[model samples]
Target chain A: MTTRRSVLMGTALAAVSGLALSAGLAPATAAEKELNIGFVGVTSGPAAAWGTSNVRSMQVRADWLNELGGVKIGDDTYKINIVTFDDQKDPKRAIAGMEKMAQEGIHYVVGPNVDDGAAAVRPVAESKGIIYFPYAFPKELYTKPASNAVLGMIANYQSAPAIYKYLKENKGVKKVAFIAANESDPLSQRDGGVAAAKALGLEVVAQNDTYPNDTRDFTPVLTPIIRLKPDLLVLSGVSPGNAPLLIRAARELGYTGLISTETAHDAAVLKEGAGELADGFISVGGASTPAIRSKTMDEFIARYTKKFGEYNDESNTKVYALDYIIETLKANPKAINDVAEFKKTVDTFGAPNPYVKEGTLKYVGTTSFGQKRQLSVPMVVTQYKDGAFETLFVGEVD
Target chain B: MEQVIANGLYLGAQYALIALGLTLIFALMNVLNFAHGQMYVLGGFVTYTIYGQLGLPFVLALACSALTLAIVGALVEKFLFRPVIKRSAREESTMLLAAAIAFLMDAIILILFGEKQRGVPKIINGVFVSDSLVMPYDRILVGVIAIAMIASFMAYMQYSRTGRAMRALAQDRVAAQLMGVNVDRYSMIGFALGALLAGVVGGLLVTITGVNSGIGGPISIKAFLMVMIGGAGVVGGAIAGGFILGMMESVGLNVLREFGDVTYLVIFVLLMVFLSLRPNGLMGKPWG
Candidate 1:
């Protein structure tokens, strides 16, 4: 009995020592805490703009955070070191990139805005317990809780509903028509539009779906929509890639109606391709400029212009917002430990959405699960005018 | 509907100009010249460099890019395609390889120039408005230039000695060599002319579509589709195919809501339909 008791004690001691060793070697306890962050994007492809913009935004945010002395974790200053991987818009490549990042000890990642890359990276993020923030608006992300680590800044699939609300209540819009590609994931987002319109006492005049992202000429679908004479012309799933041509086609066909899109935030090329035709088009999403109030936005735009020679866009704001989150998390000593605890802090943490870099940011809630934010309000509608976007509606801070 | 048809026609002519070059190369050498789109983009870039930076005349920029592309084409045919033809086992693989090279070159362009679209100002400025239908004078100018280019191409092929040699080579390269044609020289010339055509078309495209490094792949794909659908073996077939596809795509989308993806689908369907029914394309002469 004595021998057995001693053996049990010895086993307990061994287990305790092993636990102590692991605790000592873990990533959190180091003097200068180093965090590896992975960024997955299409560093090359036709839609490379999406990736490049996001990368630049993240870089700017990181630089700003480090300037303010990195993410503070307890007593240690943890410097965020981002390692980016270019997925080239392929799902297989995106998966490989995520796996490689996970293998390389990346516990946190900012992601691909494109649908294919977003879908591929989500599973890997969940499997590895890596925090993945994607810029895409695929419904599967919100419908199926992949992981607590997986979160989107915006609820992408539900924008049409929000847009429909603004149109009906604010603009007195009664009739609407929809156009989008049938095969694309974003096209499914338009499905909510008809229901939303009907709920708001608006008639759905017509609906037409296209095949690919690059379909430019819109006469066939436009003729019917124009004939229907809907007050609001809704392009629910028009990507920046297709915006130029579709807008141009509509303009060419004498469409002088109020054309609105929820996905119009990133379509910068519309200014060049459609010129004046792109004017008066309003898109519901993050504020472009002037509308968003944040000093961080001003700094971002200045630095982005200095570095990239362009104004800040959605990708820029999102990454900047994330940087603020990371920095705020680091500042709170309670968030430095396990992943679940870190997420709870994130869900509850409220800092100014200093992402706009240009104006004042006021955040409102801890409801991160339902796209509720303590920092940002509903997306403001911005109209394209004189080669720049001007804010039309300021979102209410709830 | 008439307006849509007219618009499609104008767009179709542009496609035809680019497609004709691809068709010419395919007919003579049985190579698609996947880098045709890059050559077109390079033409625009070259023009931008000349007219915008160097302050040269617009016409000179257009001429210089065309001439330079023509020379480059000869060099490419001599170096890249000629060696491969000698050991031609996988023709499709070679085409795909060329496409990969084009992709690499496009990346180089993006890295160098950055991905912003730059416009070259129109040489002529005027508008033709017909009772609410307004067409830019540049469009009219581009259409005229396209017609002139087609006429010159046809005339050269029909009348010139070198053109006849290209025709003979197209008929049967081995047979042409047997008939005292220096096949290598003729092939080089054909490639050069094809490149020259691409350069000019590229220049013309910028007048409407603006120039960006990333436009090559999509443009190349469109050109390829046009050549395949309209026919691939003859110069006329390429032009006809280009115009048909271009117009169809431009106006088809306006007519059909799902027209964007349909354009690509229609091309493949036409290709399959044509292969089973009329294998040589709509205008391609039968090769034996």
Candidate 2:
């Protein structure tokens, strides 16, 4: 009777040890179950295109992932869920979006389209340890505040310098004039323009600031611009409400010079707005020609066109790329979880992607400032001609 | 310096022309035409349809557009304003009704055409260079056209039978009815002529600048202010007031460097001070 009882106890102890080992190995072999993402941006307004496109892109990505059986984690598969709010390009609304997302337990978010919105939401996201991928062009948002939570995708405040260099090297541009609105982005960019002029041995003939945000007429400003007659007119903020007005007035006043504006050669819409006036103008954009070569990009564009009946922009591209990144992370669940792990993983993420183009998509700045995150990402300096944009400069990833 | 003056004058002329129409409607109709700017915008849209879509000559397109809008004005006066006048509705009620209609028109345009500005072809081209002072002849053309239109309009009002009849109607509807003048007919004609002027200004604006969907309300407000500051119910005052406002705007924007903002500020101050000193306006023919 004693021998039979000892044999039964040994069998029970072996069974318990086997179950413990299985549980320990389950995390590595099983799949990730779920992902929650947040989006904050100008979902509406004159620039609603930026925000709406992002939402559509993210939704498409979520659908694609779910169709592929969601992200893989320990033994179970979870679907990606996204929550979005319209910041309307307002800083106050942006902060509210960040807080709401944080409260809802969303650790990942996509955008706050403009600089002001990003700045307002950055601190809140950092304190809450949320990972915010902002798409604004301000430099301070990334480099300052000492937070690992913020990632910027564009060239930041350095686009102006880049543009100036292009002009000097390629176009033999020496004398330049600056015309910008007395607003935050334009004013800051104007400073960069001045710096570029001083650094690159270009003579600054004139620097004029227009009324902050008015479109009644720009003849008051245009007269001085026409009078100075510099070789290049760097229209620092041509996407604003007054851009068309300024351009039209400039043409009317018979001043034909090379105009380099974000609006000058960036989008097809400017071609429609400025008509023949926009022809022969130069501008910088984030996307490179090679980005369109990726099969994934082709698929994305095809899918987006099918779904939304329109092509996407760089902002949409960033959203798609980030969605791709998030899915990648989910595929490797051990890569990031809490703040510290995410910071390290994100830092090592690669450069401005050579394979993404829906519109305005870029990733160089958002990831860490490693060799991979360098600004060597491709950029296009385009000119408007024949009612279309012609590439003047196609930069390569260094 | 010469370029600045020429540019300012050019800009000011366009503003005055737009302002004149608003002032006319207000003085004669005693209702703020909120859609006055929309009428201007509509005028541009019509011209776009004629010149851009239909491929008509620029001048012919502009003329047809103006004429179409004048007819539209007559129809509006007959259906909308005529009823209000016949009912002897409260002044505020009539004004509110006009404002509502303006809102409706703006909404309709926005829904139909989207909020992007349409490029209009430049009407006149050529640079005017004198002593190294260069300015676009297109601007001079706008100013010249504005002056000619105002001069002809003033002359017609002073000499023509229909113009006198309209003036009689404006002076007192009941009194004009007591006279041999057909009050309703004159009112319709007044509204039509007012719309015609606005339509022309709209076309001119598109030629110099460009046309967008959302231009009507602000232009209407500027026109109202001009009439009030120039002198209520005075045709001569409307023209003069427009030029003065234009000059102030031009000087404010170019000379002060804070040109655009300063223009509005100076006008507001001028209006306030003038209102305090002479509420009737600078050249108002005071009845009381």
Candidate 3:
């Protein structure tokens, strides 16, 4: 009887030891699984600002996630790793970067910030069944049917109409003179502006296009436009570097009419470039001033500025993209490994509470794009007034 | 019509100022300094640092920029270009070296000042409005300064001993050396003068437009084109070429709004036609 009892006790002890050993190795294996995301954009060259800001925002988001002990997917916590490539703002380089990313087994890609970069990488992403979030301004990028790409930026059509409407109604602007950089995206924005002006019963007196990248003088372009004497001068789709110079040129040439733009969100840079001339200049889609910002947005701006040394206007959108992905993973952990499941999840995912108040992502299917993959957020019209960006209007585009 | 002409003239003056230094350097060294545009950009930054950031007077800053860049140009010639002058296979290597120097200068400027464009405040504010024409005071100032500098340079080239040596060198290098014109010393002086003009143009441009590191490459291209189109080794030809290009761009942009962005292309085509018709450019001497 004593021998049988001793054998039973030894069997129980061995079973308990095996269970403890398995438990100890479970977390190590889980920790080894990482979710790789790829960032391809212009990290050098003229458009370095866009790429650097995007990367910084993504890094901050990753840091926040890692601090929370990584994102949980299917009871397994996975650290997020961002692999980046600099395309130097060239389309061919962008395509090569995309291919390199695919070879690295990264299925989630963030951006090729400009229109050229986006167009180049779209086919690659679609063919490979990768999830691409592009920060682009063209409708053509999303026109194809049912692709795995989603545009995370406001298209020119949406913002132009709203901006023109505001100017016509509030500022009594009737005749508009339009100037844009001669590029694909800028031309699209110019078309949108023309349409918007026509719809609002406004006359486009002068329409001029300058060199996309190398124009140093706006005087020649503005001289003719100023002669027409329009009520509003629209500098559409110009880069941050050129927009302020355009404004300064106009002001120096004694243009007293209202100046507006679709870009130039960085008020500090604009102010520095244009100085007192930046006063009374209006631009679409920027970070709302501290007075109008929500709690979440304010927190985000503080964190971003602390980390990156400047307040990026697109931080809200970038953070939203990452957060949306995280939330989707939480809903279905298997989606991380399954491309179809991930794509479907993103296509049908509801808007998470965005960082900005009333800044919900609305996926609208348009006749132009024929797809509802374009993410439209609330538009904030900001004016440079008294040495700061003041929120003049906040509403949705009809 | 008045605005177009005024615009053309002022724009021409700027191009002339930018092309002057490049023309001078080519005439003296027979080496196309591809880094000339970077020198222009450096001048602008120096003026901005002195006048904009340091809160010094604008005129003093402009002078300082020109002086500093003259020194820098001399140093570059001595250390960088002087050693390469004697080699038989120097042309390709010198071009590469100029490109490398440009990239290095761009990188240094990028590191020192961030990529954001910074403007120097207008030296004089307000516009002179007329019945049919309006001119900004700062622009008029730029035009006047450009004219004064060009005239001074022309006078110096005609009257001064070093200037006469440079002209003689351009006419016949071997003869000038035989006549006791120290080729090396004159070359350094020529580069310094060219850099001084570039520095002044840069300072003026920062006040007129703005300055960023990226502008170096484009401006360099324009200056190079100006020298080629005007005449390879003639100062007067560079001035004429600058005005012609400037007027063409200004008038072309105003009249051909639809084709405004392609003004550069139009200029290029026109240049091709001109070169085909008169292979020596508008004022260039027939190549040997």
Candidate 4:
């Protein structure tokens, strides 16, 4: 019943009619809008794991939130989208990454993972009205006249003193020796730890023990430090790659004392590289321990590990940054485009913590940063066993 | 002080193993081989995959690492470096090719390995501590094994037919070719051997220090320092340079404890002064 010419004409006619109808009705119903958040950090270098974890946490939470029909803000509901840039752990690239986010009209951004990166993007963030959450611990970025940056996690200075005080009271630790990789990040953390250690009346021994970041053999580096026999040996801002090697070398050299760091570490890496050598290693654990995890947090961990093959322990703190961004925007929708309103809202902001089982989410650091520019993170210290983290204690930032 | 020597010995073993591979490629090809460290990283990952993930024996993992690197090295020379060396007017142009190869290998490694810090379980463990000398049993075993490998390589070079041919080619490429040697085939084999050495060292050291994609560049820079300290193409010089660096690090960190951040500065100045006095290093001749 159908001829070749007739079928061809009929197909052509249907195509034309469909296009005409869509074009004619295009003006009345508009396309839906989605919110964009940016992540600019070191995702391709030695410090890559932390930045990558930050992005994944942001993505996992954003994806989960979007599946819930998006978040309701004012009278409109919008889904979330993530933008990412790899700064390669360089400061110049970090500035460019910030400029790119600004070009895309993204108001809220997360990270420039290290100290120099966070500092380099400060000017761009201020001029472009972007609010950035960084893990770097620089007082100037959080201090007065610097209003756009917020601390995403606990600074080493804040955690070091708390850890040191607990050690002094419980473990009978009276003397301390500090060692850091001879780089800007670790050196800065070491200096802060030194000041904190001295303030707590703990004697400082062998504070000048620093090694080049590339040194594989800590034998020469740790030999002198071990001779001092300090009750506590503090590895300030040690990267995950170096942690196991350091612990192994120290233990091989007969170091019987306790070892600790302020940065979170991967328990699996510790087990594979250091084995029994890393038995008593202490580090900053997750932002929320198992005792404090909400149902949302458990679901997030399941989805993240499923998507990424494995999970980075540092994600415990990074998972909170995006949700806070969304929640604050919900509190005052005007802050979505205007950072001034966000600043005002941040001062009086108090909401139920989304990832934690209990307690309220609010900005602290009014005294430490001279503004409420830091997220109030639960400080959970953990000790490394075979291939797992056992919670040592949980304390809140003063 | 004795403990410092013990530490230096262990450190020297690692430095020597790393330097040998770089020096061999330089001697054979006159190529700067910037990608040598990436090959080393590839070797480490191969071993990690075999032993750490697949649950194979450590020896089999190491053997596969060596075999994989040798084939890769032979192919790279056949296609990439060999063609570039032929077409370029200046020998220094090979350095550009080497740099490009380094970038290529880095990208390849990143895609495959995913930038994770990978390691294997220790093959042997426990410490051997006596009278202020605290040496891990693994370090002692590794040092002995490295020394044996070096000695075996020397014997092979002195006796084996392929080794003699390769050495003769290094000494005089045109003359060796005229003496009925297959220049192209031997040259490719020589490069493969050099890369194989890198793989072997990487496999050995991965047990001690974890490996990742980001470590490749720094390892190359350190290899360059070792090669410079030694005579550019001399194998014996590489060994000497390794010991010298190891002892310097041990002494600099322990004896010169007060210098803190500036100890490396002092060491660098001393090295510069030494190099200024002897431009050819301890063993290099005028031409080499």
C-alpha root-mean-square deviation, each candidate: 10.0, 13.6, 10.7, 5.7
The candidate scoring highest on lDDT is: 4
What's the TM-score of each model vs. the native? Answer: 0.83, 0.73, 0.88, 0.93
Evaluate model 2: give its lDDT: 0.66
Runs of candidate 3 exceeding 4 Å displacement: A1-35, A43-45, A63-81, A208-212, A299-327, A335-338, A351-354, A357-370, B88-90, B258-262, B285-288
For candidate 1 chain A, the 10 contiguous residues with the lowest summed lDDT are A365-374
Between candidates 2 and 3, the one scoring higher on DockQ is 3
What is the C-alpha lDDT profile of model 2 across B121-188, one tens digit per residue? 56665767677466667767778998788778777876899878767766776777898888778778
Q: Write the per-residue lDDT of candidate 2 for residues A270-300, one digit (tens) a residue.
A: 5545567767767654442343345665666
Off-target runs (Cα >4 Å) in candidate 2 are A1-156, A240-245, A251-257, A262-276, A288-378, A394-398, B67-107, B155-162, B177-193, B258-281, B285-288
Candidate 3 A-chain TM-score: 0.86
lDDT string, candidate 4, A231-290, tens digits: 999999998888888999898888999899998888777887788889989999655467
Question: How many angstroms is residue A361 displaced in model 4 relative to the true structure, after the best TM-score fit?
Answer: 2.2
**What's the TM-score of candidate 2 when only chain A is evaluated?**
0.77
lDDT at B222, model 2? 77
Q: Each model's number of backbone clashes?
A: 23, 19, 0, 0
Comparing 2 with 4 on DockQ, the higher-scoring candidate is: 4
Candidate 4: segments with Cα more than 4 A from true spot: A1-30, B285-288
Error of 1 at A9 (Å): 58
Range of the 10 consecutive residues with the lowest summed lDDT in candidate 4 chain B: B279-288
lDDT of 3: 0.78
TM-score of 4: 0.93
